[model samples]
Target: MTDTALTSEATHGVALSDVAADKVRSLLEQEGRDDLRLRVAVQPGGCSGLIYQLYFDERLLEGDATRDFDGVEVVVDPMSAPYLDGASIDFEDSIQKQGFTIDNPNASGSCACGDSFH
Candidate 1:
C-alpha cells in the first residue's frame, strides 16, 4: 500500500498538496524550525464557522498525526483532521490576497470574510 494509505501519527490524515507543502516548508524554514513540523488546527471563530490555526510545534498531542515531509513534519489533531480531510492549506502572496488559505472540502459553506465555515 502507498504511504498515504497508512494511518498513524506519521500521517496528517489529510493530504498536503504540493503547493501547500512547499509553502509550509518555506514558513517552517523561516521560523527556524529545521526540526519542527507544521501544526494545523481548527478553532472556534471566523465568519463562516471555524478558523484555521497554523503553527510550528515540536511536541505531539495525545491523538495527533505526525507526518514527515521532504524534511519537515506535519502535525494534526484527530478533531481537526476530519474537518481538514481532503483540505489544502496554501499560502498566497498577491496584491488582493496574501496569507494562508484553507481549501477544505468538508466546509459545506463559508462566510463572506472566509474565516468561518459550516
Candidate 2:
C-alpha cells in the first residue's frame, strides 16, 4: 500500500452528525461536566496497526491538539493525529447497528471487523 503523509488540515478532527452531537451533548450533561471535550486517539496493538480510543477529557496533555466542529470539541494526541487525519466521524442508527463510525480515507485497508486499521 502507498503511504501518504496525513496533514492536520486534512484531518482537523472529525465531523459529527446532528444525532451524534446531540447524543454526546446529552451524555456530557448527564455527567455534569461542562468543560469536557471528546478525545479520540489511535493506539497501536489492535488486529490491525491501529485502533480507536474515545473518551471525555477535561484536561489537555502537553502535545494534545484540539479542534472544533458543530459546537463540539475534539481532542487528539500528537502521535495519533497523522493516522487520523482526514477521518470523518459519523453516527448510524439501524436495526443491526447503532453507533459512531469513522470513515478514514488515509487508511488503505482496515481489519475484517472494522475495529482496527493499518
Per-prediction TM-score: 0.78, 0.82
Query: Can you write out model 2's per-residue Cα lDDT over 24-45, one digit (the tens) per residue?
Result: 8888889988899888888987
**Backbone clashes counted, model 1:** 7
**Candidate 1: which stretches are off by over 4 Å?**
1-10
lDDT (10s digit) by residue, model 1, range 11-112: 655566677778878877778667676888998888766888888777665667776656657788878877887887667779998887878888999888
Which prediction has the highest TM-score against the true structure?
2
Candidate No. with top lDDT: 2
- Model 1 compared with the native: what TM-score? 0.78
TM-score of 2: 0.82
Cα-based RMSD of the predictions, in order?
A: 4.6, 7.2
